[model samples]
Every structure is written in C-alpha cells, then in structure tokens.
Target: MTPRSSLAATAAALLILTPTPAQAAPAYPDPQPVTGQQIIHDPTVIRLRTGGYVAYSTGGVIGARLSRDRVHWKDSGNAFAEPPAWWYEYNDTGDPWAPDLSHRDGRYWLYYAVSSWGTNHSAIGVATSPSGLPGTWTDHGKVLTSETTDHWNAIDPAVIRADGRLWMTFGSYWTGIRMVELDASTGKAVQDATVHHLATRPDLPYAVEGPYIVRHGRYYYLFASYDACCSGVDSTYKIRVGRSTSVKGPYADSTGTPMLEGGGDLLLEGHGRFVGTGGQSVFKDRGEDWLAYHYYDAEDDGTPKLGLNRLSWKADGWPVVR
Candidate 1:
C-alpha cells in the first residue's frame, strides 16, 4: 500500500491527460510535491465558461478541489460554507452530495442532490455561483425531489444538454437510472410528462447509480457504475455502459437487454483483487476523454482514493475502462 505519505513527491507533479489507450496511461498526475487530504467522492468535472476546469464532488462538507491541470487537485476549502439549513428543515438529509458544475448562458449553475439510503425522501437542487467561487454563491433552492417508493434515494446529480433540451440523470438503490428533461429557464423537469428509465439491478443484488450520458457518433452511450458504495473497504463498484440510437433509451448491452427495462453492457468490473472500484464520473480531459472517480487503491491499503484513467471506445462504439 502506497501510503498517502508515500505519495509525497507524486502530489506536486505536473499531471495532465494525453490521449492514450488505457493500457499505456501514465501514473496520473506527474511527479510533484504537495500536501493535503482529499475527502470527497463521485466527482463531476465541467470545463468552465472561461475554459478552466472545476470539479465538484460528493461533498458531505460542502467543499471541492481546484486543479489547473486535470491532476494534482488542491483542496479549495469549504466551497459551500456549510450544508443548506433548509436541507434539515425539510428533513431531507441528502444535502451536500454529488454536485455537477457548469457555466450556461451567462451564469454558473451548480446542480446537486440531497438524500439518504433506504429512503425516498430525497431532493435535487442547484445553487448559482454568480462569480463561480466559494463565497458569493447563491442557492437556487431545491430544483426537484422524489418521494416515490419505487425511485429509491434521489442523489448523484449529473446533467447534460442534448437534442436541444436540458436533461438530468440520477438514481440510487431502487428504480436504478432515471432521466428527465428540464425547462431551459427553470432548470426543472420539463414535465412534458417525459421520463426515461435507463437501468436497474433486480438481479445484481446491489444498487446501480452514477449515470453519465453523452452522444458519440450515432449512439447515445449510457455509462454508469454499479453496486454498493459507502461501505469502507467493503464496496462493490464497477463501471458499466449501454447504448441506443435515441437519447432516452431502451439501451441494450451486448446480450441485448434494454437499459430501460434494466440492463447494462459491462465496461468494467471489480476484479476479485480490487474488490470495490466504482462511483465513477466521466469527462473529457485536455485530450479526447477520460473518467475521474474514486477507487479503493489496492496499493493504498484498499482505501478509497481519487483515480483518473483514460478510456477508449471499442470498434463497435462501446467504452472500455482501461
């Protein structure tokens, strides 16, 4: 196990992503020396309006890390000051969870969720960063919430503007992956009464969440991580993907089960030695594309740590997590 202490020299290194097959990927973040602890998970990256990159994570403490290069993130210090008080007032404990940052039109919108497991009392919200900084942030309040027993906990917020519409993808435990379009101005579900179910695990014995959707070529690839998370040293996470020609899909895996009806094309699995490695967030680095997420680094006493791996698509247009 490479102790965080052992990562001393590696921390300050100049880490940048260059196009490469996952196999030939470099050891992430060039050799540099820095100091700090990374206490976060399920990070989502957005290329800023000015073209800088800001990463928002599963912030239980309402904070994030900033990096000039994709690697070597420097903790930015309490980005949210503290969890919103209304989170408790409404009894919705999912506050300060996974956050996705983006600059749209002329403002920076931070979309996030609040919830707890085994409960349907969850909500998704957004706060605006007028100037895109820790202070001067404004809460847009809860954008949406789900109390449906079949929907599971409503957290892990990811967003994309596709097909001339703004859509949000999220889920956990029950009901698997769900998607809905948003009203451009309001940033709430379009309520055009359109919703799509992407995947579920009635057979896998665990939950599937952390969905990332993007269109490539003629395919809408739905990428997700499956299994249990938050169980220290004992997690069951793996990356998975499915594809369909339509944005909202009846996505199918290799064997051909529709993602809408609960199916996936396996992209990566936690090999026995790795145990649990999931809670993924995929983004385009300076190069083509890569995935940034937390994994139980076997070399680090199996402790969950940040990891970024460059990925490539197979000839058939499916993703392979190298």
Candidate 2:
C-alpha cells in the first residue's frame, strides 16, 4: 500500500471514533407554550382514565376546568352546585381552598380544605368519583382538621404514594407543612400513624403552604409555595423545593439545609406578566414532567389564573420549572 493510503486510513478511523458531545437538554418553557382558560387558583391537574385532562382549584365548591388537549381549557362547572351542608361546620364562606387530586384503585380522590382566614381551625375533606368530571364527586366527609387549640392549620392537602403507602402533606399559616399516612382503602389517615412535620418558615412570615410531593429518579421532592397570596397585584407568592431519600423526610434544599430550618431551593417566582406564581402540583404526562399552579396576571388586572410549565432536571438532579 502507498504511504499516503496508510495515513488516510488512520485519519478516517480517528474521525469515526471521536465522541460527539450529547446535546444539552432543552431548558423548559417548552416552545409549545402553555395556554388555558382563566380564573383558577391553587390548581391541581390529573389526566383522565379515559382521556383528556382535568384541573381542580380553590373557589366556590372547588372550581373545576377541563382540557381536551392539555393545552386549551374551558370551565366545566364545579364539584358541587352549592357547598355541602357539612361544609358550614368548618367554614361559612362556602368556598373550598387548595385541592389535591389523585387516582387510586378504581376511584379518583379529591381532597380539599374548608377553613376561615388566618386561623388554624380548618378541615380537610375528601370526595371521590369513578371519573374525575365536574359535579360527579360524592363527598366522603372530613379527612382531617385542626382546632384553635392545635398548632397546625389543616389546609392545602397533597397526596402521594411513596414507600408503599399513601401519604398526605398539609398545613399553612401557623406551624407550616405536615404529613400523615393514609389508608389506601379508605383514603383516610392511618389509625395510629404519626403526623410528620415537614417544612416551615417560622421566622419569615410563616408563609409556606401547598405541599406537593413527587418521586423523581431516587429522591422524593416536596414542593411548597411561600409568602403572600390572594392579594392580586400585591401578591408575592413563589415556589420552592426540597428533597429526601425517604418518603417521610428530613428534607433539605440543594444546599443541604434542613427544610425544617427554613431551607428551600427557589423554583419559580414572579416575572413579566406573571405575578405571585405559586400553589403548585407536579405531575407527569406523556413522559414529561410539568409544574401546574396559579398565578396573578399583572396584565389581567391581577386576576388569578392557571399557569403550567415544563419541569427540567439539572445535571445535579435539582428540579426547575421554566
């Protein structure tokens, strides 16, 4: 063989063996922008068993909306035409607060809160339906509550199955987020399980609430909303997160600071037309992780509306919503 032919073969071999860098994953705000119906708060989204998507939020009888394509949404009435007769026991306002929706067995569970403002006297209730459609839920009565004598407010209920058990995370205002075990069959707390205290911001307005827990890879992430909400243009709510290896956590932020010590990694904050974005629930659909929440729209006269964003993981495994 000619000397030049030998050199050409060596060059071609090197070109074929040189590694090409893997393309960096897209950083969310997925070019497919999020658009939907207006007028929802503390929204929790779930894909239907048959098809389509549904979101439930805080408002009269727990407001609900529907999405045929998971992009466009329309008002689909509510869970109740009027507040349940029993709702007056904990709240006279007739509106329920942040709701957590989940499916198990052959039923859909919608857990919500009925409580007065600025008080720990609150109750968390659950209703179930075979299909998660508006006006089809049958109220199962109270799942948990707190009295003036208790330290934690029993609001903002989020449910997840982890470590082989159904667990609930709830609380607000007074003492921060708390969790308890749920009986898989009845959707109620386990008869003798302890109520585990999770995250808190006792020194900073004590404003953490709406705890959504999801398992990603090998870690369990707890997402919470922080600071003020419901003030319209003056709202200051934002989302934060922490993680633990165990379902019941000694959770810590990205920096290893304990969540109980006010440790939270910032996830989302107000920007541009979106103000006070918080009250989040995380879910996976079609292999993509999404953060669903409510935001005060500065452009819409500070009206609270639904907000959804794609969530991406960093190289180190922290979750970010863009």
Candidate 3:
C-alpha cells in the first residue's frame, strides 16, 4: 500500500478499535429485590429508633410505607390525614412531594415540598412527629419558599447537621441544586440565609434535582438526580454524585469536575427491567450505609417502586453503590 494510504488505514483502524461513549458505559446493577407495596416516588427512608423502617414519598399527603426487613414494604397511610390549610397557597389540591425524614433532638423532622407541576412558585414545609409514623405528624408550616421571579426552585429538601449547624440542600430545574442554613431549633430557614448554588446543567432546562447530602469520612458527598423523571418507562432519570470537604460546597466529581459546572460521577441508573433510577437518599443501618430511591419498574408497567442498595466506598473515599 502507498504510505499515505497506510496512514489513512491506520487512522480508520484506530477509530474502529476505540469504543464510543455509549459502548464504554459501565454496566449498572439492578436494585436489590423488594416485594409488596413497592410503588413509590421520591422515597426517603429511615430506620426508626423504636425498630423497623418507615418511608415517606410523594403522593397522598406524603404517603407512608412500613418495612420490617427493609425488603418487604406495606403501604400504611398518609403522614397527615389531610393537607394543612396553608398548603393550598401553592397548589389547588394541596399536594406535597419528596419528604426528608430524620430524627434529631428526640423528635422526627419531616421536610417536604409543595408546588404545582412546572412552576417555581413552591415551598418547602416542615413537620414534627414523635414516632416518624403516619398520622402522627404536626405541620409547622413553610420553611422556605420561592416565587416565580426567583431563579431557584424550592423543592426536594435534604438536611444534614455539620459543624454543629443545620443546613438544607434543595433545588430543581430552574438553576440546579442549592443550599441554605436552617434554624436548628425551629427547622426553618435561618433569617435572610444565603442561598448557595451547588450543581446545574450547562444547558437550558437544567434538569438536575433531588439533592441529598451525606457526610462520609472526611468529605461531604452531594447526590442528585439528573435528567427527566415521572414519565414512567420513558423517564431518563439517573443518580450522580460529587464531594467536597465542606458541607457548604464547591463540590467536584472524582475527576475534579466541579458540580457547579454540571459535573457528577454517575452512581446509579436504569438497567434491564429497572428504568429511571433516581430520587435518592442515604441512611445507615447497623453501621452500613445504604441508598434508598425509587425506580420505574419496566416489568411492572413502569410503576415507580422502592429500590435499595448498599454503598461501598472506594479506597479514595468516593461512594460506590453495591
């Protein structure tokens, strides 16, 4: 062959041998098997001090589910018998979404969002329950709110206590993930708190939401759902994560890509019968960290269902969902 032709042939061979991005994508694992009352969305689960696990999600006035073994769930009821009168300010039906459940100061705090579809006029509300069970919660009213004029959407709240202060990470679509300080005593936003930006898409519609922060070892990790959700099998939702040394972050992924610039390491995504895995939270059980989220089950006609996975850390301290 001519030398010029040989060089062209080598270039073509290299192109043939190099894997495309899709071909090089990692094979993701399916969620551990869960049975009974698996249908859910934006699930936040925690093991109670009194024993067993309780989960709150988006539906039916903060829908509730109970699980004994963490593998079998049963629908219990709504956290509240009826919506608070103030919730009607955001939505006509008074619907709530994506609750964060945690135990602090001998009480259970539930933080959730209320808003209509496709609008930034939203509020994050707080409530307290002695047992973290359905029907026992007392609504404390709005903790934070966003008007249509605001750049950030006030939704998908996840709170963590760091440096002896309470902080909540929340946002969606409008400008991605954001954080603000909370009054520890009241579980409400600190008066005139600074809203810190965390993550976003480089493009329009942004598409990142459901921010959850967990402190693992020396780093504070930020986990957020990316792309669209709620379209059943057509949903493109996936979970991604980044880490920073400080809870109020300039977080970056494993490759040093800043989350503020739309960078995150993929932690979980759809595979096989599981589709659109996102809306995630992290909690510890028996000293082992586990991820709790909802996935659209393709085998079940794209019904959103409970998904749990144990998280194992790399030697470098990054989380890997097992």
Top of the candidates by TM-score: 3
Among all windows of 10 consecutive residues in model 2, the one with the lowest summed lDDT is 25-34
The candidate maximizing lDDT is 3
Give the per-residue lDDT of model 3 (tens digit) for 1-322: 9999999999999999998776566887778888889899999999999999999999999999999999999999999999999999999999999999999999999999999999999999999999999999999999999999999999999999999999999999998999999999999999999999999999899999999999989999999999999999999999999999999899999999999999999999999888999999999899999999999989889999999999989999999988
Ranked by lDDT, the better of candidates 1 and 2 is: 2
Please give, for residues 1-322, the per-residue lDDT of candidate 2 as tens digits. 7999999999999999999889984332422345666788999999888999999999868888998888888888898778888788876767799988888899999999998888887899999998989989999888888899987889999999987888999989677999999888888887777889999984845889999998988999999999999999899998899999998999999899998989999888887778898989987788889899888888889999888888989888899776
Candidate 1 ranges beyond 4 A from true positions: 1-37, 49-52, 90-94, 148-152, 204-206, 271-275, 299-302
Ranking by lDDT: 3, 2, 1
The clash count for each model shown is: 9, 0, 0
How does residue 275 of candidate 3 score in lDDT? 94
**1 against 2, candidate with superior TM-score:** 2
RMSD of each: 13.2, 8.4, 3.6
TM for every model, in the order presented, reads 0.80, 0.88, 0.93
TM for candidate 3 is 0.93
Each prediction's Cα lDDT score? 0.69, 0.87, 0.95
* Candidate 3 or 1, higher TM-score: 3
